[model samples]
Target: MTTGHPFMQAHPHQPLSIAAKILSPQMIQTIRKLPEFHLQAWKILDRWAFNSPEMLAQLEAQGEIVLMSRLLDQQAVEHQALMDSTHQLQNGMTEHEILEMCEIHTEL
Candidate 1:
């Protein structure tokens, strides 16, 4: 689910937002078109962020800025609220939730 956008900000274990969850390859394609923005996110990636450089390159090389902008928009959307949104699952997909869910429920 990377476009090599140089953002390197995607958490390996975390679920990407809906845009990514639904359109991964397409997202990467969007980033390939916007190198500058990708680089910006890249600066923030690490153990505390999206630290994978190889994944970043995949996003950038694909020109998936729509996905890049979508990623930024995901951040911006949260910035507008400044509240906690960790428990809410996107589109009711328990497996798609970023935080780990109850394994018992998922296994059922």
Candidate 2:
């Protein structure tokens, strides 16, 4: 992916304006020159990318990549939270409970 790609964001909670920085000149041109022929057709350019299979595939692939990245990111956050909670509790769960939580986390 190119620089400034949404998936390349360094932080999960970065502002949307940062993601919007991906609109390069070439992307703008590509958007302007999309091949829509029917004047009477009620399709909006914003929705055209979803209607094109190739474009949709690209978007879906990127979407999947983003989703997987976020999923892993969330697990890291949850694990850190659990560790922090354990530290604060001064007494942790039994070995069986830890093993069960590990199993459930991996299944997710």
Candidate 3:
């Protein structure tokens, strides 16, 4: 994807802007351009890159590398919390209990 593409900062949480429209090339290139007809269709591409699972695999196969990502970062935080709790309990908490807790965590 081109880094230099123009973007609209439409939403605080989203990095890219939603375009008002995607115009045909013939329509966009005319001397009297309709700014409203142009939009950041680039975000459609961005969304697939972010939220898609199978699409990421295809992109990886194509050698278009991306950093590993997760939809639920809270899972990581929870795992860390569990690890800390288990370590603090060391001799007090049985291994079976820990394993059961881990299973419950995953189920939830």
The number of the candidate with the highest lDDT is 1
Please give the lDDT score at residue 5 for candidate 2: 23
Give me the runs in candidate 1 sitting further than 4 Å from their true place: 1-50, 80-108
**lDDT digits (tens) for residues 78-97 of candidate 3:** 44555667674475554224
Compose the digit string of candidate 1's lDDT tens values, residues 1-108: 423233323444433332233334554355446554443232222211334445544544566554355456544433323223333433343222322232211110
In candidate 2, what are the lDDT values of residues 1-108, reduced to their tens digit?
123222222434323222123323443343334443221111111222323435433443475445334334544544554564574335645322442455533221
Kindly report which residue stretches of model 2 are placed more than 4 angstroms away from their true locations once superposed.
1-62, 87-108
* Residue clash pairs of candidate 3: none
Candidate 3: lDDT of 62? 48
Candidate 1 local lDDT, residue 83 = 26
Give me the runs in candidate 3 sitting further than 4 Å from their true place.
1-67, 71-75, 87-89, 92-108
Cα lDDT, all candidates: 0.36, 0.35, 0.33
lDDT of 1 at 28: 36
TM-score of each: 0.28, 0.24, 0.21
lDDT (Cα) of model 2:
0.35
**Model 1 — which ten-residue stretch has the worst lDDT?**
99-108
> How far off is residue 82 in model 2, in Å?
0.6
